[model samples]
Target: MLLMSRTDNAVQRFIFENTDIRGEVVSLNNSYLDALEAHEYPEVVRRFLGELVASAVLLSSTLKFEGLLTLQARGDGPLSLLMVECTDQKSFRAVAQFRDDIVEAPLQTLLGKASLLITVDPVKGKRYQGIVPLEKETLAASLEDYFAQSVQLQTRLWLACDGQSSSGLLLQALPASAELSADARSESWNRMTALAETVQSSELLDLDHETLLVRLFHEETVRIFEKEPVRFICTCSQERSAKIISTLDRKEVESIIEEDGQVAMDCQFCNHQYVFGKEDIDSIFNEKPQIH
Candidate 1:
């Protein structure tokens, strides 16, 4: 069991003793609020973004990569996109792009013909991407379907967000050991998921890791692990911003600087502005290898 406060921004993992089942619980407080503060998202959008953030943290913990994992949902409706990214270090950020007149509606209605894209980018290895059409009513359901198709393990997700606090729980069935038969593994997975389906959104958001886990799985032996802190960390820096500028045509960049006195780049995730004067632009162009 974890000793951290219930309201703390953290994630904890647990395993069922003597079983090949593992789970995770995550709650986002300040990090969720900070992501919302970056834009003027509606309450409905805020709630969805919260769930995305919580889900990202939960899913990132289950991965074997050492870099970044991104979850992006895109469509051609009022709600154009919802994206959340989490790194192996437990830091994450989220952003949403939508029409100004977007209103509260069903997930499919909001994102017409939408699809969920999961991208895993390891710092040293090759990146992997999985794309699946989003045809469910809720984000969690869509993700559950994705897992069912992409992975061999049985995976389940429970997510909730009230625009203030967001939380999620994940349970996955690992490969059966030599001691445990396949029937036993299936039975355990079924029983545990059935119990988890009884969880309420309020309980997930309000109860701490220990209390919540005990409430759900009191009949079983659960071994809780240490909590890992999660925070809002934007990976935008002036150097990275400069790299983007280098990709643009030098003549066009010069024209922009001539008219506006300086070229500016704003990050969509954090809204941080990066400005480059003439000298900075000159230095960047000079440092680059000209094809000439």
Candidate 2:
């Protein structure tokens, strides 16, 4: 069966038979709603968060390692930060930060002069990071530029989200094999990308996987694969927070305890707070000698 049964929470990948074109489709519901429940975000911020969540999931599907892909956008604007992280397990988490006075505006208007930073951290290897200026107005466009610059691959992405669900569609041209002519691969890539551009955001977000695929690629022979489930899984814990506090200098730790009564750390992704008192701080630092 080329079309897998719908499981309500899975990411689907597909490949064209005769073309060196591959794609991914992801729809996030429960995971996305859980992230939004952590805070009261403005509508614009929520929408941006949804798109980001979908984009991260789509990109993570392309990886072949046990790692995490983090997409972050930072700018000096009302909406200061937005981030989404996806791990090899297909787990994901996301959050956004904005000023109190942030008004409802389009994403470009909200995050002017921003930059998209993508970081890949392998479980046992050195981390890789890429920084791309937000030259395009939309998240999808900027990510397309990232693929162009970093991977030298032609890519197209359409990301969309309502308050309840987030979804995205991605198409990338595979590199030509040694046996294939470069011109032949390039021509196929161009044709495939043009077809991919016809995918509408509404279709991507609302239609069923089979219906959407047939609608978009009915003219071409395509092979669809089984879907992978994507879910929200936070990596924050009290132990992790304590370890973070242990790294700070004794004086700085003491100052936080003195001013706030306890050193409190909050996970930006989950809004889970960890509080450590003076005694806890002392225990963490007492074992190590001070560096003079």
Best by lDDT: 1
Q: Model 2: per-residue lDDT, tens digit, 240-282?
A: 7777776787898898888998988999988999888888888
**Model 1 Cα shift for residue 102 (angstroms):** 0.7
Q: In lDDT terms, how accurate is model 2?
A: 0.84
RMSD of 1: 2.8
Give me the runs in candidate 1 sitting further than 4 Å from their true place: 1-7, 289-292
Global lDDT of model 1: 0.90
Clash-forming residue pairs, model 1 = none
Error of 1 at 155 (Å): 0.5
Off by over 4 Å in 2: 1-7, 287-292
Report the C-alpha lDDT of model 1 over 1-292, residue by residue, as the tens digit: 5443565799999999988999999988988898778788898889888988998999999997899999999999898999999999999989998888999998789999999999999998899999989999889888888899986568899999999999999999887762278888888899999999999999899888998898899999999999999999999988887877888899999999999999999999999999999999998888863321
lDDT values of the candidates?
0.90, 0.84
